[model samples]
Target: MNNSLQTMYIEMVEKALDRYVSTQRCNNDHVLEAMRYSVLGGGKRIRALLVLNFNRILGGAANDAMEFAAAIEMMHAYSLIHDDLPCMDDDDLRRGKPSCHVAFGEAVALLAGDALQTLAFETLARNTSLEPAQVLQAVRELAAAAGSRGMVGGQTVDIEGTAQTVEQLTGMCMMKTGALIKCAVRLGCLSVGADEASMAQADIYADAIGLAFQIRDDILDVIGSTEELGKPVGSDAEQQKATFATVLGTERAQSLAEKLTRTALDALKQLNVAEDDPLYEMTVELCSRKK
Candidate 1:
């Protein structure tokens, strides 16, 4: 996307998130604080941006897609909250700040994560501009992507198979890290009434980019400094977690990421989208992002 369009999209999303956080109230102040801390914590917000960009590319208005984008980010924030729990990754830091569990205690963090997940569904359901069917579809997509068959399942594999083969490692990462991103693109297209063929093409684009995103992340963890990443670097290696870089070597993993980016971009060519479309450009930009 053009710089001006990207700036507008980011500002719109930031405003929506700010308003949503301000409007929320909780019976328990501690839980609410934890929720706000986790949601408002700095991150790239790439998944939400994908939703907005894809909606625009499919001829949907940005205002029409704003609620859905915010919902996606809420769900993502909740996932991170839970993922950092002691039972999961047991992370102490996220985005350069103390993790929810570290800052607010585990019990409050868990409750906050639960609240965010529910709020995501509520956001979509209460959006007046979306058709009932569209809202329902988005909910279904989010549920499937975040449930046992997707992110949760991938985490299970990652925990259970610390010494897995290259293929197994790739499979786990694809589900754990890639599923929500794929859902983001799919839901955006659905919001604008994309045809089956178009959705199928979008799926192809998501699959490639999603995997590439993880591979690049793995590469970055090895080569990038903690200051640059805004979080602890080499944690995956220190934990003996299975990663593309662990199995494929850093050089080979970087090559694979490049290949996947190429495949993702090529998949977009099969669609009838414009060259200057925000979604098309965003896809390319995401693959090229330094962070």
Candidate 2:
């Protein structure tokens, strides 16, 4: 079931992004190509999957949520593009291919990232299926998550080299990586007009899985090969970044990830879904994912 749902949702996201980007009438072909190169590049599309799956579980139309899901993916792609810039992580590869800046020039890559970020809001705002109020709310949610109060803020701390404790490192990971993830889940619930209680439950589920996802990423950096990660391994160590494995050691990091996965599973159980829910299955897969 998890395999099937993952395949289906990933296909949906790919198709949506392809159609949307292909139909765009851009004045600068190079920047557009850069956008396409970055966004259409391979990824697990987990955030978009979370949106679609949460909407499905909440009785919302997957079709209606498709635009929103694609928008979140675009935002994620934008983040990755910037993250790989020479001034940032300075990586030359992503998803086993040249990073956006490496493929396109630095200027074009910067514009592409900016364009993709604007495209995310544009996609959400232009979706006709959702109400204006809902779109606005989602925009606000994404802005808060991606802006200084969230992902960007965490990144600021990360580059400043100030995370001196395990707690601080955890906080940085939560914001830098978990903010958008949590927002993805919440946006799906909002698309369906879920109540406060339901949204709160979604919050719990997202929070746990989001942090767990980062922990797994950190763990994979230590043990996963470059081919497996689709990027250079040991980048954290190379950059001297603080990570769960660096701060807490391998055994404790793995234990904490397991605990977080358990917390996510407990939240899934509270959703009143069946024991074999796809969301629950996906969460399990996320907790133990090799990539």
Candidate 3:
């Protein structure tokens, strides 16, 4: 996206997250605090931006999409919190700060993640602006993406160390990382009643960019700095995890990302979208992003 619109999205997503976190309540405030810390912690908020931008493309109101955008971010934060647990990635850092498990005790961190996951669906269900059918459709989409069929399934494969090839690893990445992303974009269309053709093109674009995103992430893990990445770099290699960079080599991984970017752009073009469409720019920026 152009600098101005990109900045606008960042600001809007951040504000929505802050507002949502502030509204959450519980008798034991500690878990809530941890949830806030995890959800409000710094990151790109790419999923949220995806929802917002796609909603914009479908002529949906930005304000109307904020809740869905924030919901996606909550789900993403939940996944990250669990992903960094001792039994998972075993990372101590996230977004330049202590991971939730490190900052809070593991029990509280675990509860925080659970809460966020549920809250995401709650946010979608409670959105009264959309038709009840639309909200239900969005909820189902998110549930499938976050559940065993998507992110959880991918994580299972990753933890089992079952992937042994570039294609296998890429498939895992699609489920683990790209599923939520695809859901995010699709949610925008569903919420706005975008036609089936629009949704079809969105699927094409989301699928391509989702894989491209993981490839770029693998590339960053190889070449990125700890400071710039806001987390430990080279963790994939340290853990001997199969990744695009490891399977295809760095140069080939980079080329694959570009190729996927081209595919995403082509899909977007087939929709007859404007030349200045934010999705186009965002896809380009995502392929080249360093952190």
Q: Highest lDDT: give the candidate number.
A: 3
Model 1 steric clash pairs: none
Q: How well is each residue in 40-155 modelled by candidate 1, as lDDT tens digits?
A: 77677788888887787777898888888888898899999998888988878789888999999999999999999988888877677878888888889989998898888988
lDDT order of candidates, best first? Answer: 3, 2, 1
Provide the clash count, candidate 1: 0
Q: Give candidate 3 misplaced runs (Cα > 4 Å).
A: none
Clashes of each: 0, 0, 2
lDDT of each: 0.83, 0.89, 0.90
Tens-place lDDT digits, model 3, residues 41-85: 878878888888888878888878788999999999999999999
Residue 277 lDDT in candidate 3: 74
Candidate 2, residues 1-291, lDDT tens digits: the string is: 347877988998999999887867678899999999999988989999999989988999998888889999999999999999988889888999999999999999999999999999988887889888888999999999999988899889888989868788878988999999999999899899899998988999898999999999988999889888789999899888888988888788989999999988888778886657777777888877877
Off by over 4 Å in 1: 272-278
Worst 10 residues of 2 by lDDT: 273-282
